[model samples]
Target: MALDKRFIGREYGPFTYTIGAEKLREFALAVGGARPGAGTPGEPPAHVSPLLYDARAAKAGPYFDLIAFPSFAVVFAVRPFSAAIADPELAVNMLMLVHGEQELEFLDVMRPGDVMTTTGRIENIFDKARMSFLVVSSESRNQTGKTVVKGTWTAVIRGG
Candidate 1:
């Protein structure tokens, strides 16, 4: 079954994701970047109070600025998207799909100790030539309700 267009505009989630400094640095290191968070450290930035160990503060440092890399949002999108793309009848394999476009607008930068959330919705779907394209928009917000980032990602569904 193809993705039901009726699902468009339907919001899914409020899923909480704790953006820990450890996780951030780990993600960075996994991609061969800096290894700053937990176990491996080189003193975080001064303003990164969240990493300070109580009164035993070491001193903060620069953290993972995801966009500086590429498509870092993948860490946050896998689950919801897996569910979204898994329409058993569609015969669509999201992996073989191409990431045609990606846009992220950040209202605020995520920081350590921040509990953020994400919600996704299908924004558009169109067919052209021999394939279909699905555009899904998801917003990540901190506990304060501040939108940390909004991602607009497109996937080309082939053989649809």
Candidate 2:
């Protein structure tokens, strides 16, 4: 069965997330190829910037605080996309779904203690070559109401 194109433009929630220094460090280190152990985020690889994991360095750096990796926005920004995929009304077939693509734009760096609110909507729904495509566009704003991130998430369902 084909996905209902009528569901296009359906909006998802304004999910809120608080950024923590530890989580930011963990994410950056892990993505930078660090291995985590009992209590540490592991040794950050040479390519990983100290500003991402060293509090002192970060405190003295340009942002003057721990900064999350650019892609870290996905942590909070993906809520809307996830919600849409799980919406009962949409009836997306989980077994047949696959992430097609993702694009994120970081307007500003994310810092620890920043409260992020994300909202998204189904931007488009279409079918091609026996497949269905679901596109969700999300926007994330900081506590001060500045746009911090924008993301386009795409999901493909086979055998549309």
Candidate 3:
């Protein structure tokens, strides 16, 4: 089955999510980080930082209490993913599914009390010998139009 390329350059809504401290802790523990708080390089500590009061600075460490791990965003909003794959032209090949690469960019930290929305879509698709590479993107935002997280998800699909 061939993938529908129409999704390319398409955009989805700004899905919503709330960052939680426990989620950050769980992500930290899963990553084998003995350090109290460890996050993506160039990112700040997941533990509460001193810059919590400023709206702009507050986005820095939202992962501590507001975000589960980066993967948590998948759970935070799966509908967009489902919608993309469920499309008739997308060809849902579960057995041939393999995660290729994942890129996460945090625009700001989302605090627990805040609400977030995540929008996702199929970005591009590449054809390989007997498989295909699908690029998907999702953006997480607060109600106030602040981007909490942006993610690029790549999936490798095989032939049944």
- For model 2 the TM-score comes to 0.97
Question: Distance from true position, residue 28, model 1, in Å?
Answer: 1.8
C-alpha lDDT score of every prediction, in listed order: 0.60, 0.95, 0.62
Q: Candidate 3: TM-score?
A: 0.64
For lDDT, the strongest prediction is 2
- Looking at candidate 1, the ten consecutive residues that score lowest on lDDT are 51-60
lDDT at 81 for candidate 3?
61
lDDT of 2 by residue, 1-160 (tens): 8889899989998999999999999999999999999999999889999999999999999999999999999989999999999999899899999999999999999999999999999999999999999999999999999999999999999998
The clash number for model 1 is: 7
Per-candidate TM vs. native? Answer: 0.68, 0.97, 0.64
Worst lDDT 10-window in candidate 3: 48-57
* lDDT score for residue 3 of model 2: 84
Q: Model 3, range 3-96, lDDT digits (tens) per residue? A: 6666676665655566665555454444533344355222334653333322344455543433344455555655566566656566668676
Which ranges in model 3 have alpha carbons more than 4 Å from their true place?
A: 9-14, 33-74, 77-79
* Residue-by-residue lDDT tens digits, candidate 1, 1-160: 2445666665567667776655665554455433464567544444433323222232333444332122344567544454466646444577657877878886665656677778887787777766777788888777898877788878787765
TM-score of model number 1: 0.68
